[model samples]
Target: MNRRLFLAAFPAVLAAGCGFKLRRFEDIPFASLYIDAPHGGAVAQRIRSALTSSKQTRLAASAGEAEAVLVLGPEARSKVILSLSGAGRVTEYRLGLQLTYRISDKDGRTLAAAEVIELSRDITYDDTQVLAKAAEEQLLYRDMEDSAARRIMRRLQSIGPGPAS
Candidate 1:
């Protein structure tokens, strides 16, 4: 194909390809959006890392630069069966992890209400064998937290300051 023909077809090919679009949570940084939580834990750390600009603080403090706040609620609960022996007796144990979270605006308006995000994953009775499963569970938990954070971000974006004139 000649250069002229290639160039002419390139535009069409690009157009035919999947039309990509990007969405941003907000025009302003997260630091500009204030956040408050009951506890400053791992999830809180992740939230700070993911935010555009973050100021880690407890629930009591007020965010002067922020327009919103995120308040974490009660922890969620769940159970997971570890293992079963051939004799039918419960050889292994069980474990669970709980999650609770919430988000709101600085005006005390609940932009995103509080809710629980709980998960249950298993580990075998054997010490070495259980390590892999534990790792997997950790990954799964991380993913869950990431997903929840993204959801909150999207929600905040939806409730944005309105279209820029």
Candidate 2:
């Protein structure tokens, strides 16, 4: 291409690049969200806490008036990996949590589904270190759930029946 044509096209390309935009949080009318999960386990608590901490949606007490319901299926699995010692005996353990989640509207229409959000961390053999590692893993799982919530929000905003800006 000639320099003149290149320069003329370059401005259009830049304009096109800068024209791309994503819907902001205010564009969605999701005032609050209801999260359904048993609270006895750490993973469940993490899931609840993640939703509550989200900037996108306020945490609601129930699904009655919520714009969305985050239903946590179950504490699917807690996988334990036994690392072998030099003599082939168990030396250390790594624990992992896998969770499935789905978001639905107040009318029970499915909005978005995430089958698995897996989080894990390794722990030493010592009891004290094990407790610390467990806490760290819990935090990691919370972070994973938070990321999943953000993804759900983006999906919902993209494909939902909510009013567009």
TM-score leader: 1
Each prediction's total of clashing residue pairs, residues at least 3 apart in sequence or on different chains, is: 2, 0
Clashes of 2: 0
Cα-based TM-score, every candidate: 0.57, 0.55
Residue runs of model 1 more than 4 Å from their true location after superposition:
1-16, 20-31, 38-40, 53-61, 74-79, 82-85, 89-97, 119-128, 161-165
Alpha carbon deviation, residue 14, candidate 1 (Å): 7.2
Q: What tens-digit string does per-residue lDDT give for candidate 2 at 29-94?
A: 467778787666444465455545556667777898788787876664454656876766555766
* Model 1 vs truth, CA RMSD: 6.8
Model 2 poorest ten-residue lDDT run: 20-29
lDDT score, residue 48, model 2? 50
Residue ranges of candidate 2 with Cα displaced over 4 Å? 1-29, 41-44, 47-56, 76-79, 124-165
- Among the numbered candidates, top lDDT falls to 2
TM-score of 2: 0.55
